[model samples]
Target: MHQARETDIDGAALLAKLNGWARSLGFSQIGVADVDLASAEPGLMAWLERGFHGQMHYMAAHGLKRARPAELVPGTVRVITARMDYLPHTAPAGWQQIEFDRLARPLDATVSLYARGRDYHKVLRARLQKLADRLAEEIGPFGHRAFTDSAPVLEVELASRSGLGWRGKHTLLLSREAGSSFFLGEIYVDVPLPLTESTPAHCGSCRACIDVCPTQAIVGEYRLDARRCISYLTIEHDGPIPLALRASMGNRIYGCDDCQLTCPWNKYAKRAVLPDFDVRSVFDAPTLLALWGWSEADFLRHTEGSAIRRIGFERWQRNLAVALGNALRATGDADIAQALQGRRDSATALVREHIEWALAQRPQAC
Candidate 1:
């Protein structure tokens, strides 16, 4: 382990100034965390052992090293955890009700609220790097690297340890001030900053998140079966989605926000101050048929610089086809059936199978 060089600097004062820089960069809060995360390793291993990660093999590939920051990034003595609220600035009062209302409409294509914005990975990485540069200017050049939901970092663990917030029962870091509708980013540095005090978990007896999951993904408090999660099925899992969980997916084409939306604490969820998290117009209230109308080229062009692009066109259509199938069963719309037939011949085998399932949702003229 490399030691942080002593520079006769007041760590608390330096952190205060650094917090100012973080605020200017759009971070709502910042906390200093010691790099020792050994205690969290066992739970990480157990979750992997249960295969809760599903097809995300990378979670297991990192093994126990994910809980060890020094192993992941040597010379890291402290991690600066940041929370950036992602609810769009234009999101009105009672936004959760609006989200639930959207889900009730079978024809509406509901992308997760966070993903409707610009790609957060790029936004947070760039801004976190700038925060590191500002720290370098103050303390002279220092060894540091930035991370934002990338690589093998145990982000929620680091955030909770650093007192950004306590981990909610749904397994997301939640703050009484910010709620769960935020993006987390971190800067691993060699600086030995004073650690922030941790907040006590306030979940109490509330099992709102556990009760709200459509797929029953939350097996228990702080335990999740990601394989059964709509968010995981829609965004992370590759190849054919399991048929058992498809009906629970509803019209959520990108990610599911049921747990967070149902959590009473999320009533305190804050809106993003930066325009970078603004909602794209095409996604405002797009119908499943409208998104299905887009050619692969249109998908690429429209989602340019957006996180949804990472899923690529094939998976994009696969998800839409599932939602279209759900819509057919719910709305009994003939236009949706016609749309499914229009694309059946051209779809890839994976998409064709989903298209077949969609077409079957409606019966032929007997």
Candidate 2:
């Protein structure tokens, strides 16, 4: 490990410098967290035991190492957590209502706002590395590693510990200044930086996030059943989506933002300082039929530099098929039926099953 130089370091001054560099790099905020995360282990174990993580085997595979950052990265004494607001600057003041309105449109494909732009993993990871490099240039070399949702790191735990914000009832980091419309990145470093004070949670008596869930994925406050989560069903779970949850998924083809959309704190969500988070044109107002029209090559070409591409074409088609099914059930649109029929024979087995299910959907008599 290339340790930081043995010199008298002013922790406060170093933090100030870090904040400045972070802001200049499109980071909204930066905080330091001590590596002793033993307190969070029991909760981690319980969540895993409940199988709430669904198909994300990696969460269980990492075991308690996720809470023990020092074990994950030897010589790590503090984790520097970063917050980058991801709401596109073009978002209108009543954006929450706008999103809710979008969800009501059964034919429109609704993606999680975060995944609408450039892949956040690529954006945050590169920026975090540059931040680490800047620190190294200032105080000589240091043993450090950067992570942005790419590892088994207890990201929200570390971020909350570092005073980024309190954990919202929906299990996402929420800030008074930025809400939960942001991405978090971390730099595990050997530097003994001053720890930031964790903020008090402000969820109060609100149950908006819990009530608005399409599939009741948030079984309780701060407890998400990933198995039922639209985000997980569409993005993480690589098998057939549960029969019960498909209709509730509505037109969310990529990820669901219903929880975040309903959170009162999100009214304060900040816009991204960098253009990297600007919504891609293809995703801006995509309809289920329009996206269903994309061939595998078109899907690949369009999703280049996108997080959506990581799911591959098969899952993409599968998600769209489910959404089209729900749209057909809701509107009985002939065009949607035609689109599903056109793709049925050519679709992979997984997608074909969903397409078949879609073709079977008919509007119920009221």
Candidate 3:
């Protein structure tokens, strides 16, 4: 537990300096959030009470500590929230429609746009650490820690409070300038910075994201049932996907972007200026059979240093199996059945069951 004495550093002026340093490190915007998040706790408890978080026990494990930043990081006074756009450099205009078309293909392996390039956790963490280093140089080694998408912190709550964005109906932070296609990182510091002005809620009378959800996972505005979300099914949950939600998954193998894609604000989604988010050539035209053919060794080789690697081989196969099941029904390709059969004997029980489900999806011929 390291502590630092605060100097006569003016809060407003320090925030302006931080904004410049953040931009030089590829951050699009920065906002200072006050530490008190007591108001958000009831909604957090209610979401957990409803069993909407699925297998992620971590959300409940942290409890109220998530909202209490000072408790998590002793002496924390203000949280600096940063947003960075993640749309790949090569992504064309009308990219939302492009993603929808990929889902329609059924045989194409549709990874969420964010996961196609360098792991955002690695990219954002390194950049945030650099921003911290720059601050320490000027501010005489101030107490600080950086976090990005780590389970314990309530990142969206902090971002919303700091004027980074208003929380959308899908429960993701949405920026008027950058949309929701960006990554958020935070620096918890002991500086008493002036808090950024909070944005007004802008979701007036719009349920486009709610309607377009294939699994209807957005049960209501700002409420997400993670159990039924394809993104959660593919990445977060470690067991077999629910039989009921398998068909609704379509071709999404890594994460689902349906909610973001349908939101009208996303028409203004900004492209990543940094090359770290450039889409890998492997993901440019990902197909089910090509990805399914990857041996465990191949999977390790290709996804090295990637966010997809974190899911491990077993969950990866489970997600692909579900996608193959959907593909079999859509195209009825015998090759897909052959592919499923090839993996049947050696597949783990979790994956084997998904393979069995995929095999059943092959229509019985008259």
The reply for model 1, stretches above 4 Å from the true place, is 1-3, 363-366
Please write out the lDDT profile of model 3 over residues 116-168, one tens digit for every residue: 88899999999999998998888777788899987589999999999999999
Where does model 2 exceed 4 Å of error? 3-7, 364-366
Q: After TM-score superposition, what is the CA distance of residue 211 in candidate 2 from its true location, in Å?
A: 0.9
lDDT of 1 at 10: 95
Q: What is candidate 2's lDDT per residue for 1-366, written digit by digit as tens?
A: 455334478889988999999999999999999888999999889999999999899999989999998889888888999999999999999999998899899999999999889999999999999999999999888889999999999999999999999889889999999889999999999888889999999999999999999999999888999999999999999999999999899899999899899898898999999999999999999998889999899999999999999999999999999999999998988898888999988888999999999888966641
Q: Could you estimate the TM-score for every candidate? A: 0.98, 0.98, 0.98
Q: Which digits, one per residue and each the tens of the lDDT, describe model 1 over residues 297-331?
A: 99999899999999999999999999999999887
Q: What lDDT score goes with residue 155 in model 1?
A: 94
Worst 10 residues of 3 by lDDT: 1-10
